[model samples]
Target: MTAGSHDETLAVLTTACAAVGLDPSGAKPIRLAENALWRLPGGIVARITRAGQHQPTERELRLARWLSAQGLPVVRPLPGIEAPATAAGRPVTFWEELPPHTNGTIPDLATLIRQLHSLPRPDFPVGRLDPFVRIRDRIDAAVTLSDTDRDWLRDRLADIQSAWASLPEGLPECLVHGDAWTGNVACPLAGGPALLMDLERCSVGRPEWDLVSTAVKLTTTGTISKTEYERFCTIYGHDVLNWPGYDTMRAARELRMTTYAAQHAATNPAWRPEAQHRLACLQGHNGPRPWKWMGIV
Candidate 1:
């Protein structure tokens, strides 16, 4: 789809900038991420998103502040600007922008991911951290799938269900960056080390959950090597067998993503191409079975 009209799209950014006491006119937007990304002068990034109702801005701000306090390399939030409060509207967060990242060396990324997963897993007082459940619920709520797609999803999820059903309750859990893709990671910052962004999906869950997503991201990007995968397993201190549960969740996650893409394709046809690419990947069209993650760890 065509990019939104400059004035029209800028209206949202303008409001967000005004809230932060920044002059939108002076700051030309430069970059955007998967979500609503806007760049301002002086290396500032404003991310306006509307994904979850759980106060993403607040959660992210807390994570950023916590990581910063711990001396972990993390993006710092700009002070003095409260992400706009719109009474249940998703909050927009502003962050201290850094320089462009060098995507070349990824060795640091493996190390950083290990550190992130090392964070103490806190008990969420509100409820259990169940990514699979959330994904399943979304699939149920998503639009009706085509007959062929429905059957494929059903068979895949059934496999996941059987695997999950056999797992004992109270599996060892840890705090993991649920979406630890390469894009979420960046080169070392001049002042510090490499930082991990997109903590919005962070949660306390089985460690394997992080591994599965990380593997999928790496595999899709053709960056993961067998040796590196083994190193990741050793670093995380997890048995390779636990991959079953994670693999199941990963496939389900893809199904949920496909459903979301189906909706977005209505306005952005480009999304359709990406969606097909993901669909083929999930279906194991060009490589080993997607279930390969189940036992390989």
Candidate 2:
């Protein structure tokens, strides 16, 4: 997160805690991005998200409660409390703080994902994945990008949107952890196995879409070792690359990742080079794999 936004988060945290009669003093900041995360001394984690993100925040709370009822090991919002209150006009939520543990591994993630996919769909409203929603914002946020770059990005987004519309179903559409990836899973929980977090994009979609994140990390970036990649497939019981519609989905995923980095470059200049490299690679001027993607604090 940028330095300028830190104060705003602290101020919002204070106000929100005061409204609930919870102490905000000595709260520790965890992450600051689309949401501002703070860990309160009372062992609860507070999430302050953008005001426009209210609906998703509400959906997330519903999912959390649902997961808990299913005996899932995922995190849960605070019980017996009204949530998603406006803190400085931003939506804020409280979660039960989990005990410290090692970061979840790819195998751990695959196991959790398998369990998640097995469940019948919840009664709550959930639509299919929408990869195009962030395109406009990401494009507009690239304030310093060249006109040519901007044009190319817009064209790519348009092409992907069209392609996504007709994507053949390889795996049966299931309730996926929409943003499933190693980053979204936490290690063995206190009473359960691997834990999945980040339910913002939880929706019914191609099961393969969730696996694309790992596939990209392995094939496109080569950040993950081949042995590990194979293990992921073995555990998950399918190699996504061999799926007929894999390339199409992978391409769309790459474009979204590229656009995400590009959008952040406007506020964090360090993201520009990586963003440019990603765009160039997509255009076939392939840079070496295992890109050093960093700098979005």
| Clash counts for the predictions, in order | 0, 2
How big is the positional error of residue 249 in model 2, measured in Å on the Cα after superposition? 0.9
lDDT of each residue in 215-287, candidate 1, tens digit only: 6544434346667766666765554344445555555555655655644544455565555555566677757
TM-score of each: 0.74, 0.93
Tens digits of per-residue lDDT for model 2 on 86-112?
A: 776788888988777667899988888
Query: Predicted candidate 1: what Cα RMSD to the true structure?
Result: 5.2
TM-score of 1: 0.74
**Highest TM-score, which number?**
2
